[model samples]
Target: MTRLPPVRVARAATTVRTAVQGLTRRMVPPPVGVLELVSGLIEANTVYAVAKLGVADALARGPRAAADVAAELGTNPDATYRLMRAAAGYGLLHQDGDRFDLTALGRPLRSDAPDSMRAVVLMIGDPRYQSVWARLPESVTTGTAQAEAVHGVSMWELLDRDADYAATFNEAMTRLTALDWPTVAAAYDFTPFRRIVDVGGGHGRLLASMLGAAPAAEGVLFEQESLLPAAEELLREAGVLSRCRLVGGSFHDRVPDDGDLYVMRRVVHDLDDEQALALLTTVRRDMPAGATLLLLESIVPPGSGPDFAKTLDLDMLLFAGGRERTEQEYAALLDRAGLGMTRVVPTISTISLVEVRPAA
Candidate 1:
């Protein structure tokens, strides 16, 4: 039996989903379709509610009546049933009579699940964060982040002040990195590089994975000082602490030099063009002539078809005052920084390894 690559499977699934959406739009009245689009928030909030309420975790043991679950959770039975019914409608739960069970789709909502997404759901659906999205119109009109408008602080500042939120955000990043890093590590050959610097590496998961793959390579995990302890713990857990150096600093200020391979994963999409250029220029200045830089990012594809990057771009705009870029946009940016993009290596996940080097 032959197994298909995850990237190919993902693309096929996307194609099927697009076709289904298009067919539904063509069959439904325009007004009805638009109403469905506008009312998406209802479903989103429903999912958030169930995830927040521990409904998924409660159902993990076995199927149970909503009233029984509600009694355990100290909520109203009827409301719990209604919520569970809505979740069933969304295919996250299954209902038989009055009993509800967690579906495979909802399994990740459990904090103990192998690929848990509970933190991600809570982080995005938190009322404070959702309020920032409410100011999207203002963000679009002013072309700036709405975090300060909503929370009276920049996103980074808010994270610094709110320890719980910061922890959740870090956990979410770790979860995402867990899903993407193995594929990213396999997508490129790291064995040639003796020193690998992961700029803004969060919690050191990605860097740890690369180090495991490239036993010959020592790693530099550069991140804010506050994140160093967590990164150090993760590196130690991965058994790569001896092979890694945990550096505390801001990439905006400086990055470690002379590394043969430098990686910045999901970092550039969080900055505006000017800030991104400055950071890239710093890297270019520090990079040795023969060294390589790999930016692991979701390259926004051309055309009107659906891509998560398109939706993520809007989230970046409203939350961080940044935007996702296309291949051409990245190439131009690299050229301005005295670097040149050599190739884009696709990974099993949506992200790609964009290879670059100091310009000749």
Candidate 2:
């Protein structure tokens, strides 16, 4: 049987979820439905608690009594049972008598899982992020990032100061990239480009994958000086180090020029309109007349229906004073920067490749 494309599968799943939600709202009183929505924080924290406690890893081998898991984790037995029971209610685990087993949904919480989300859970649920989110009202009122207000520094500065938090943040980004890179590599043809430059490329994983797809193309990984060492190591492991050059600098100021294709993934979404335009202008200044700029980003759809990009837009506002944009918004931004959006190429992943060229 021919399998449906992932994009179609995702749309189908969203439709089903929307129908189920509608049914649920109809079945419950308005106040009850609203209250249920309010309790989402509890559910999110529960998942974070279990992931932090290594409960999923404890049950990786097989089902085990809650008390046994607590013993293995050196926690209070009764409390562990309650937490595991709560997790079961959330579909992360299955309870049988006093024992609990990790559900398929919970397997990704394990650190060793191929699609592990442990770092993402920990990063979002960390007290630092939570505290910044608590100030969302302030962010909305002032149209500014709350991270600076809460942490007394920008998010990037905070990352530079806290090594542990930086490591977790980097790993979370890498994990997210791992899920989309293969789809992106297959979605676009890179073989025609002799030089590929990945602007703000972190960890160099995406660049490595691109170079692998275009064996004849060399790559330039542009990032902060502090991140170049790690990117170098990853490039070396991918066996593309011989063909890749690691450049250390801020994209806001400049980027290496004369690349046949410039790729920026999830980078523009981290800036407000003015900053984003400035960055695009910097790229445009150096872009060759025939070069292409491929921006891999989640374009906000026209309607107000549920989209991960919408949620991420709010997160960006709260943390970095950035916002996700729609296709028209992107086109407008590119136009102001002397560039024109040629087309948008959809990938199996949430991100789409926005193909652009310098305006005449």
Candidate 3:
């Protein structure tokens, strides 16, 4: 006699349980109510005054009277106070009588601070990016990205086709990259590799920094041909031009033929599994035996915490048609490319270096 179907068995068990115990409820935090709803929207800073005044940068060291800060920034004292007070209430600053100081939470706003978020803030606060988020509702409705709708093109295409937007975007990345690469250079070991290529290395920012940190390591920076001029200038500015070669190309087609290491920073997440694996396969095939592949990106966690990268993960979904991945997902992607995860290097609270190599 064949056994009853599993669904039928489950339904019979559920019916018996429901008869025994009428109903059940699970606990969860209640949704935000009306007052909280208004509070959330109304609190969004208008004019982003603290950023405008460079208040966070100024107060990073210690507290100062409003008059002094105003004098320092060449602003009216009373206006500065109001802005500072608004910032204080927002937890970016603390107030003591008429004096203003950096709260512990505001330390990340310091331009010189490690993993400083000022650049990120600046990019987000800009009209272009802000506008993109504003249209997110429409993006969700149509399953098309805001950038494409607003600008009449995809972000990647615009970044390549439009010189002005490319310049501004690259400038923002340059600022953030300048702040990050110094730490990455001083921390990561690059002594084993004679040649390393930074594929899809826009403006060659990371390559320049890596070369600066590892003096003996020669480098190649591969970027879109249209972006080559800017990448060359970046290398020149980095003072590593003589030590490196510039290859204007696409990662989808080819990478440097012979390199021990292929470093792609913040590139993998811009692709889905198929595209990501294709890129990985190309890198694996191109890289010499006994080589390393370092994917410098933040690893998405399994469950929700106070994940700062969550916003970017959403941006990946809306903008790139991509999303951040957990370690298990990365393992599968690597396995598909005949590579394996050797180790993970946490560079900071927000970033990690995923080390990969060919399977044995």
Candidate 4:
């Protein structure tokens, strides 16, 4: 399947939305419905604000007066009461007089929750990304990334220059990996490979999971210098540090040569075709003949019906100058890098395991 550009995807989404609107108009008035749709952007930002304020965390013990919550979070009392009331209206909190309590929907936003969304919310709502998203029209109009247009640099470059933002972004990614790795580990068979290398694997969570799953399989977590400590700590905590090697290097240059299986999760989508091919070429330089490579990512299905990858495609367009690709599109990319697409294994999660090998 040939991947449609972002503009076409947006047009198609609008068409689908229009059809849904027509059906909805049978009951609700069109103006009211459209206004609700328009207000969705504000609602999303409101959630972000509360998430960043750690409102759920503040209310973790019990309900508190809005003034108390505001004092705890170091914000204006009146403003906090207004936010709390709005949040209650949105089902994120429950308001009782001047007090507010966190709802189930809001609990996950707590900083200390096991499945916390605090980092995810913070990273997504980061001013850097928000400013870029504000200029999304530039991406749509110029067919280029909005991050570059707004910040005069790519999102990756911006992160590099801003250490604090980069740390938050990394935390968010780590949280996401934690959410997805269990499904991937359960779905894929990693027993055959003796040595597995995870290229660009940040903090080595997935590699740790893989190593745990395949006990006989020693692993290497290949990433930049800055990420090694966290990766090392994670591997140690997983009790697989002895079996895992932490290598600091850029995939653009080379990957470790000793692995029989190489993996990249959500890595290729960070680069354009040329950059992706270059990274793959570097992998090919080190991968032995017949070694396997797996790309675990969300595979964009054509003619989408409620697929999140379609939304992510626009994010790629705006932030990374890359794209979410269909299966055929991935096969072509693999072919360009002297790798042959062998198969794609669907997991319980939205991601798929795309298997490839060196071309014969």
* Among all candidates shown, the one with the greatest lDDT: 2
How would you encode candidate 1's per-residue C-alpha lDDT over 144-209 as one tens digit per residue? 999998889999999999999999889888889888876776668889999999999989989999
Off by over 4 Å in 1: 1-9
Assess every candidate by TM-score.
0.96, 0.95, 0.74, 0.89
lDDT of 2 at 344: 91
The residue pairs in collision within model 2 are: none
Candidate 4, residue 234: how far the Cα is off, in Å? 2.4
In candidate 4, how many Å is residue 84 off? 1.6
Which residue pairs clash within candidate 1? none
Residue 290 Cα positional deviation in candidate 4, in Å, after optimal superposition: 2.4
Worst 10-residue lDDT window, candidate 4: 1-10
lDDT of each: 0.90, 0.92, 0.75, 0.87
- Per-residue lDDT for 1-360 in model 3, tens only? 223334345446655775553322112223534455456533444224566468777886699998889998999999889888877887878899999898777777677876566666656666666677777788678765668877788878877787665666776676667665644654478877788888888888888878876788899988888878888988998799998898987899788887788898888988868889999998888877788899977788666443546767778767776667888889999999999999877544355789999888
Across residues 1-360, which tens digit of lDDT does each residue of candidate 4 receive? Answer: 233334345556666886886687657777888898888888888889998888888999989999998888899999989988998999999889999888888888899998898899899887888887787788889888888777788787887788899889989988898888766776688999999999999988889889888999999999999889988998999999999889998888889999999999999987889999998888888899979999999999777355778878888888988888899999999899999999998765668899999998
Candidate 2, residues 141-160, lDDT tens digits: the string is 99889898888999999999
Decoy 1 TM-score against native: 0.96
